[model samples]
Target: MTRGLVEDEKKEEETEKKAKKAAPAKPRKKATKKPAPKKRPDLEAHPTPEKEEKAPPKTEKSAETPPKIEKKPEEKPLEYKNDIVEVSVYHKPGCRIEMQIKASQDMVKEAHKKAIRTVSKQVNFPGFRKGKAPPEMILKNHPRDVDKSWQQVIADVAFKEAQSLAKVSLLD
Candidate 1:
């Protein structure tokens, strides 16, 4: 019985080795070329020649001349400050808070300024003194920081309002 068991084990090991050898190795995938992009119609070839000709020309200006920067009109703040934040709370097995914040341009601008000031204090930018640079310039240097700050401010405001508006404890 012992001899028969030893022979069976040896046969199983041989079979496994044979099976591995019989199986073919997977071939690597060849890189395929992407299709060329479609050509767009030229502006000069468009049918609206009269509209293009009517536009004013600054063709004589040198390459070094800075482009005219147009200041966007500032949006007026909401008449009712209370209406700025609308919070919705769902009370079920688990509490869910949903908030829609309507921020005027002025509010966003203020948040950006605050974020810029905070970032500038921590980080040193070239050519400008620390925390003394313009808000717009500082914002350009640390866009992610400004965005995060604004989002944090908005979320804090929303959560505070939601808690009061819902009147139900969210943690419970």
Candidate 2:
């Protein structure tokens, strides 16, 4: 009986080993490649049409509007006057002269107007286009800034005239 039992156990072990060997292996999964990034549009290669490149029409003026009255170019307040600014120089030692500069009311006003025009070009005001802000509004809102710019304009003109009269190079 013991020999018979031992023979049955040996037969069961042999069958288990054969079943495992007969079974097929599972298939391995392949790695997937990532999609490539898209390229940007080439503007130089394909330029925009001329019609599409045009700027939007200004709202202030239209073809149907009445012709504006032309004023004399000299009437503009920004016209610079070289003769209006009076300069008095006191002689000193070492090629250094003490200069006294005085600008008339008209000249000062012109300088202020010119400064406004310059400042207006750089800034944008509400309901106004670039370089088109009213002088009154610019003066009212930025008085100190406009005054400083006007002073700088006066100094520049004075220095240039002084340099020419002195017959010497102003820059060291």
Candidate 3:
């Protein structure tokens, strides 16, 4: 699960950078190919007297082979074909989402354990000692299963923060 996303993120970033035109340097334009340089007139081979100087120097062949220039096709604008959803920010009282979201999801889980203990001390569990389970252990047992549980608590805190702001009319 973790491995897959790491690789995916690289590709995603590359596409995003290209789409946003955030590349460090723009792509260089490609060059066209040109015909190979011709043999210099002075460097042309002088044949020995034995063979009567090879057929008048093959001049017709070089003349027939006109110099050619080749250029690569221009690239199109960088297009991000991937789907990107839009998002909006709504100001609400007692919303602590910004501050709350700052903490890692794990921190929320820790807070939940703390809350659970706080609640459990005043209440009782069937077989366990009162508040015996450490927040860490309770969390370990639940493990990654409570993935969104942290977010819910954070959202709740954010709502409370937002509401607090609203109470003071800050959001107004």
Score every model by TM-score: 0.40, 0.46, 0.27
Q: Which ranges in model 1 have alpha carbons more than 4 Å from their true place?
A: 1-81, 94-107, 127-129, 168-172
Candidate lDDT values, in order: 0.65, 0.73, 0.53
Taking the tens digit of each residue's C-alpha lDDT, what string does model 2 give over 1-172? 9999999999999999998888887878889898896776863477656664677786666656977999645321122234665556655559766666667677677777789988888778989999898988888888888888988987786667655654436645
The candidate, 1 or 3, that scores higher on TM-score is 1
Tens-place lDDT digits, model 3, residues 40-144:
989989876675555556677777998788966643322211111111223334762222223345546665665555544544445778767665555555545
**Which residue pairs collide in model 2, if any?**
none
- Model 1 TM-score is 0.40
Estimate, for each residue in 50-122, the C-alpha lDDT of model 1 and write its tens digit.
5545656557674568888998664442222344444433323334434344555655566666766777787
lDDT of 2 at 72: 48
Instruction: Sort the predicted structures by lDDT, highest score first.
Output: 2, 1, 3
- Compute the lDDT for candidate 2: 0.73
State which candidate has the highest TM-score.
2
Q: What is the lDDT of residue 16 in candidate 1?
A: 99
Candidate 1 lDDT score at position 131: 84
